[model samples]
Target: GTLLTSLTEELPINLKQLDNVEKTKTALTPVFTQFQQVLEQVIAEGKFTALPLTITVEGIENYLEYRKIDFALGKQTFFSDWLPKAFIQNTAQFETVTNLSSSEVAQRIENLGSGEIKLLSVRVDSRNIVMRYSR
Candidate 1:
């Protein structure tokens, strides 16, 4: 009860008052800061264990979902429109490298004649690439 009252006082804006995406985005920083400060205070005063504390803020999920949509739309717009224009404007600084033929690569390796060649085993998974070097 005391913590709730302290959080209520520390928060700049009431969570219930944020009706739109813009308001929620604007309040996100302050709300997060207040919650973090309150949690830190509680931990510092030895009221709760910091290691396994799970503080759930109601209605924050809605704001996070809206923000996620906003982020995706912004990313799409940036990649589709702004990035192309920027690349076109800076074309001189960017160079396109042609793919080398397998024979050409083999010839280059042959030219390096009798040197120790290290082989690498690569494994590609959905989330990561694991590469192991073999002598």
Candidate 2:
């Protein structure tokens, strides 16, 4: 609860009130790609089981769904449009690569180290975007 509260409070005013209709999935592609790239690096070095492949983006949270993947290679991962939209939405995650900017995402990716977190799918419901992850 505390974390969620902090996340809400820290949300950018511009995006907090912004309507999802005006947002474009293309706008989020770069941020998601950056995250994917990070995981891919881990997989290439044998740090993670495989590179995260599957990804989905939505406008609402309720539409988000999770699936079990028995893939021959790669991990699973997910991300939302909020914090990323507010910070790295149009920026480069590898550029800063620290907490100086997007602390939440930076910390999450940093913790993964050389491991790939597969994002099974993403559901963008009316409230928030939910990302699915798997080993």
Top candidate on lDDT is: 1
- The residue-by-residue lDDT of candidate 2 on 4-56, one tens digit each, is 11111222225644566445444455666766776676555443432122222
For candidate 2, give the lDDT: 0.31
Candidate 2's C-alpha runs over 4 A off are 1-13, 16-18, 21-24, 50-135
Q: How many residue pairs clash in each candidate?
A: 0, 15
Model 1, span 1-135: residue lDDT tens: 123434443444576767767767776777778888878876665444211111111122243433332332234211121111111221101111112332332233234332233212233322222222122
Report the number of backbone clashes for model 1. 0
> What's the TM-score of every candidate structure?
0.24, 0.24
RMSD of 1: 22.9
lDDT of 1: 0.33
lDDT of each: 0.33, 0.31
